[model samples]
Target: MRQQLASTFESLKVRNYRLFASGQVVSLVGRWMQIIAIDWLVLEMSGDSGTALGFVMAIQFLPVLMLSLVGGKLADRYDKRRLLLVANIMWLILSTMLATMVVSGLATLWHIFVFAGLLGVVNALETPVRQSFVSEMVEPKLLPNALALSAATFNAARIIGPAVAGGLIALFGSGTVIAINAVAYLAPLVCLLMMASDQLHRAKTKPTDTRISEGLRYTARRPDLLLPLALMFVIGGLGFNFPITLALLAKTVFNTGPETFGILTTMLAAGALVGALASSKRRERPSSHVVMGAAAMFGILEIVVAFSPTFWAACLLLLPTGFFMIYVAQAANQRVQLGVAPQFRGRVMALYILVFLGSTPVFAPLIGWLGEVVGPRSGLWIGGVAGLLAAITAFAVRCRKRDVQISVNLRPRPQVRLIEPERPTPAEQPA
Candidate 1:
């Protein structure tokens, strides 16, 4: 346990990555604060249209579906550090504009929605770049540790961001809190500029004859890679990780104050941070079966979370729910990265990002509307159903594959023990 603890901070031994880690910890907290602020702001502005609130969430992620391929290509083609620097700068500008609107007392729901979409665009481009950047920041052996550390940093922010946002909103209002979040963007930007440039890995993008189809073709041919990718989209992307549900529950079913809402998110984050920390210490990438099993378990927990009668119960349940959700997500991620060939990694991963992040647009509104019409519990039930279904399907796919492999193993071979008539004739001839 002590060794794992020591090794988990392995990435931070790299001076540059350590610096980057610190900035993101602060920045992610701000991002979480922005999330709570926006969700609550839109819910307040629109009354209680669960579907509308989900739309607000969906629109933010729409860019992932639309632009993630380009983002991946760009990440592969450009200097990741520079791209992040630019993206952070853009976020700062957008956030400051949001702040300006707040200060002028002219902010509206559209402003939040529009900025949310803008942030999504930045994220679609930025995330792939971010994922790929860790390898550059550390030695190959420490890469997993770096990845673990990064997840830990994000989860830590998750733990802190909501509680702070809730208190800030309760005390001051959402506007100044948003402005503070905007200022927070600068931390990452400054960190990016200061990082050691020579240490980063620069991926060379081969100018492709088939640029558009490249990412798709890579996945179509490899089942080991494709199956998990598909499962992740179904389970992780479309079914699990229901922020829309979180928004709806906080606003409608609970009819609670911001502090209570913050507590809910904080609990989820607490679980997530723990999950991240635990997974980070693992010496090897977990198997697909583990990932799928965890994915299914997450759904079951969501169903449990759905029936909770009180805030603390729901909050307590969120811990395990979050732990499983990220495990499903990160497990799939580690498998895909380790499974694929490096040459096709850029676009193949582009598709992975497309499925992983892109599915938000298609389902966010659906889940939100489910919560709206059926009540908050509906999302937990429907989302749980969707998650369990995906897991069962993945299990079936695994079973069918095993059955095929066994059939092949048991298949008839060239005769070894018997050729009775011919052999008798040969023996007679020899006699």
Candidate 2:
């Protein structure tokens, strides 16, 4: 057991990764806290209008869809640590502004929207740089372990942060929680400054390319990269709007407040943490089949949660749902990063981010509107169906490609004998 545990956490042995990962854990928890607080705050300000909440969510991610290509180019051209430091400082400033507004009783719905939009801009710059930075922090062979451990850290924070935020919101209001998140941004900033810059494996600098469409062109030439990204677009865009769906579930369907909402998110995060740990322990790289299977399971579980008769039952259902969600997402993440060339890692990963997160702007509001119209359960059904269909489509394409290869092989008539070459005698070898 001890051996297994050590292997799962082996990435921490790298001094740079350890510093980055440790800082991320603290920063992510605070980020999640702010996320929950924002959701609840929107609900409070908008009188539980799912549409309003969706609008807030959409504005936050819209910039990624629009400017992430540029962000990716910048990541490739510049130092990731420096970029991350700037982003963190921006977040700290924004969070402070948000807290001040809320505390001073001047915050309105538009204030939340503006803050979310500005934060989204920071994310557009931060995410792809951070994603690609993992490769530089550890050896190529340990990349999978490092990525998995990062996911584990993220989900573990998801588990604790929302629950704590829920309690804090109940006690101190959203302003105080936002203030705490503002303070949390300093952890990563300090960690970045403390990192041994000389020890980092910096990517070879490439000539700057101002053409934002180059990344899209690169992805178009590689089906391996394209397929996983398509799956991500579907699952991420349509199926991963849990903030809207889960928030509605707590406020509308369950008739509960921040406390119960936190519990629900915490349950989801617990399952995600478990899944991430399992991914970290795997000896082999996760294949596309694994990603598809996890996506299918994620969809099915969302359907189950949709029909759950009680809030507790729904919470229980989300545990497995969360597990498969991260499994699919992280598996796809590993698949892309491992296959991509170093020169294109930033740009390809930016496209990956574009699909995985940029799509959120288009879908969040739709999901929210669905919840507002037919019912909150309707959004879950839509999301689940999208996931299920994405898995099926990927599988069908894989089988078709296999069938085409089999047909060609069957027509070939090579009758070569399969024999091992004679081993060289010991005396025949060069001294």
The candidate that wins on TM-score is: 2
Residue-level error in angstroms, candidate 2, position 286: 2.3
Per-residue accuracy of model 1 over 119-182 as CA lDDT, tens digit each: 9999888887787777678776676667777888998998899999999998987887788988
* lDDT (Cα, tens digit) per residue for candidate 2, span 92-161: 9999999999989899999999999999999998899999899899888889999999999999999999
lDDT of 2 at 3: 94
Residue runs of model 2 more than 4 Å from their true location after superposition: 207-211, 404-431
Model 2: worst 10 consecutive residues (lDDT sum): 422-431
Q: Which model scores highest in lDDT?
A: 2
Residue pairs of candidate 1 with colliding backbone atoms: none
lDDT of each: 0.77, 0.89
Span of ten consecutive residues with least summed lDDT in model 1 = 422-431
lDDT for 332 in candidate 2 is: 92
